[model samples]
Target: MILFGRLRMLLLRTIAYLVDSFILFILVIAGFQCFLLILGLHPFIGRHLYSITGNELHLWLFFSVTIPVYMYYVTMFNTRAQATLGMRAVRLQIQTPGRMGLGKAMLRASVMLIPWEATHVAMCYPKPIWIDNQLQSPLFYTALGLTALYWLLPLLNLNEKSAHDWITGTNVIQWQVPTSKKP
Candidate 1:
């Protein structure tokens, strides 16, 4: 396999993430519709999503709509391809020291939720582990500051492994052609 350095890997990761985000957007929409239909709340999907302000159940509702997204990523990572659709598009694959064990893959999936979901605070309002609580300014800024640092930590590392990567013991690398032929 071809290992990519920090800059190249980050560029590729961003592209792959954008592509995956689009896929996720579609999944989220479809899943939301399905969820609405199942709950007889189809008519409320549009407004409810945007106006989730004071609803206590909105937290669980959001997770219900989001679980399939995590499933897609987890399943793709564990598959023989070992890459999501976006990763495949960019000619990248995830690698571990050896063939990734099932447990590692599962843990990687769970750990991935950290940075992926939480890092957006730098660019937007804070989202967090305990979002049920109202976001006071101090807490919001604190989370945003921490998230900014979390996102930047990979840049400080030569290996390009982000916080989740370090926790999960995985790397994103370029795909290698089985045989090189140049005459």
Candidate 2:
């Protein structure tokens, strides 16, 4: 029963994450398209659209997607809702004994992004992983281990708390909306 309950929470959390990711993905793509459209509208600058490359493109992605996603999580977690749009949709919220302040929220958000950033860094390596017939980068393995640990922590713990929650001393609980019956 306990295992089943934990699994259910895991499923909910996964769904919430997917929902939030979809929201961000759409926003990022739309923003990128809008930028392209604006450039296309300018006769002089339109010709230079194809010139965006290398570090410039990377910088755009970092600013447009990474920063916004991090800020979104940090702000939402610290807000009165104590949940992202996805978390709220699934009736889940993060809580701590005391109010979750900005510093703690930022910490939690940063920890949550570790696996993603690690994986990206590993993939961005100039050399292939099988160089010299050996696993060239340990970073890929580290990222995989982190991803597995983050997913499995909730199941292993009685409280169903993930790595971020444990590190930040926070809890992701199924929120129950209080109902007021009119007398």
Candidate 3:
């Protein structure tokens, strides 16, 4: 029974994180593209900017967006004791074993923001020459597969050892607000 409860919590947390990430990703991409347009770097389709510039500008954009997003995710998870927008909606929070702290949150964010994930995204360029042949399609696929597996790790908490929980030494538990007594 305890194990099942933990598993349910983990699944909920994962779902919340995914939902938040998807929304944030879309928003960030759109915002960045808009910024580019304002600066006269517009590409016809949002996803084709890299192809148009031999991936030079694409790399710049990825780094620019990733750093701040990572900082925000880690800081919030560590200090405010919540996942980003998505996690909060589902009432899930990332916390350390005793109390959440900045160190743990930063660690979690660092691992989550592995460079390979960003590099794989850069691999989607239609022109093969844009990226090194050594890191072409196969590397991209592997990184993407790993990312999917990471997200799915929450489902493996049948015994209460979820991936995110393990990574951050934390657990996602159901939240219940305490009632206040009226004076």
Candidate 4:
């Protein structure tokens, strides 16, 4: 019964994360479009798109998307609400041993993204992992395994804590709304 409840929580968390990611995707696209508009290059995207070199694209992606996403997690975790927009929607909040500060929130956010970074590194290698319908790169396999383990950590533990939560000493729990009595 306890295991089933934990699994349900995991599913809710996953749903919340997907919602957050979708929101971020839309926001990023809208922001980029506005940027191009401000630069007077919105109408020239088809022609000027190829002018952005691979390194430049990487830098833009890291600065414009990755950093903001990381900061979003940190900021939300440290807020009075103690939850991201999606987390709030799902009635979930981050609970810490102490009042979560900037440093702790940042650490939690960074640890959460490690698996993604590992996968990015694996894909950026010279040789592709998928060759002739088979995955041939050790690095890619390691990254894939780590990503699975990272998400599956909650299922392996009684506390229902993921790897990032354990590393940062935080937990995701159902949020309780305070009720006030009218005088």
Candidate 5:
């Protein structure tokens, strides 16, 4: 019975994650399209865009919007019962490993967003080069590798133990609606 329950919870969580990812993906794409449109409309705005180069403006746009959304979703949902959308859809809740608070959620989001995602991007580049004589590629690649490991922590729970849950001292629980007693 316990194993069954855990499996069900895992399935539900996976579905929720997929749904959330899809939504965020669409949002991020739309945001970038909008940014491009704006840049086309006002070329001057593009001149001030912060990027390694004008060619990389889209990367900056993606990071700017997606990171904040990711942080908000994880921090809000992981720390609280309802994530921005997933928990509410499934009627699920997140509980801290040791206690209830937003600190772990925030920390998790910060680590995943900045280091993990950035690392993945870095890995895409070939032949590192110094930017302003600074070695930035190595740092990003290292961060990417570590973040990938951290993200996989949840997968460890496939056998019923989550590294993420262990690290944050957190657990996701299924909420059962109470049946009314006979009057």
Candidate 6:
């Protein structure tokens, strides 16, 4: 099987992330449209998405969709197909030394969510809807700061492994597929 070099791996992974992010963006929009429409609050969300951001129901819906949506794409896809749609398109697969189990696949996916969740929280820190007080604690900033390191983890290694990889003992690699070429 052909293995992807560092540059190739990083490029494919970045493309996969962009594709997957677009997919999530579409899903979030559709979900919000349907949910608000059902609640008959469509008028409230007529032009501004910000209208719903502070709504408790909207927050609930967002979290509900966010966790399962991401976990499904990351964990279920990795567990079942060994790759997500974007990763499949790029011919990248998640590999482990032994038979990859559901738990480990799930852990790998969850670990990858650290930066995403942290960034979300950091952005919302000023908003008092989630809590009465602004979340400006040192611990909060520290967690967000760690995400910076998490993102840079891949740069430190030649194999292009990330913090999530080191945490879960999983590797993202190129998957070999037969290509047809006519002579």
In terms of TM-score, the best-performing candidate is: 4
Candidate 5 per-residue lDDT, tens place, 39-105, comes to 7852335453233452353355445555656666666655435344766577766654454556677
**Top candidate by lDDT:** 2
Better of 3 and 6 by lDDT: 6
lDDT at 24, model 6:
68
Please give each candidate's TM-score: 0.70, 0.79, 0.68, 0.80, 0.57, 0.69
Q: In lDDT terms, how accurate is model 2? A: 0.79
RMSD of each: 5.7, 4.8, 4.6, 4.0, 6.2, 5.7
Q: Candidate 2's error at 105, in angstroms?
A: 1.1
- lDDT (10s digit) by residue, model 6, range 161-182: 8887888777788885658999
The sequence of per-residue lDDT tens digits that candidate 4 reaches over residues 1-183 is 988998899998998899889888777767765777789875435655545444454455567677878988899889987899999989999987668999999999999988776665565453322322225667678889998998788888998999889888889999978799899
Task: Please give the CA lDDT of all the candidate structures.
Answer: 0.66, 0.79, 0.63, 0.78, 0.56, 0.67
TM-score of 3: 0.68
Poorest 10 consecutive residues by lDDT, candidate 5: 126-135
> Per-residue lDDT for 53-164 in model 2, tens only?
4345445456666788899899999998789999999999997887899999999999998887766556544332323222455877888899999999999989899989
Candidate 4 TM-score over all chains jointly:
0.80
Instruction: Give lDDT: candidate 1, residue 173.
Output: 85
Q: Clash pairs of candidate 1?
A: none
**How are the candidates ranked when ordered by TM-score, highest leading?**
4, 2, 1, 6, 3, 5
Error of 2 at 74 (Å): 0.8
- Candidate 4 root-mean-square deviation in Å: 4.0
Shift of residue 123 alpha carbon in model 3, Å: 1.9
lDDT of 4 at 13: 91
Cα error, residue 57 of model 2, in Å, equals 6.3
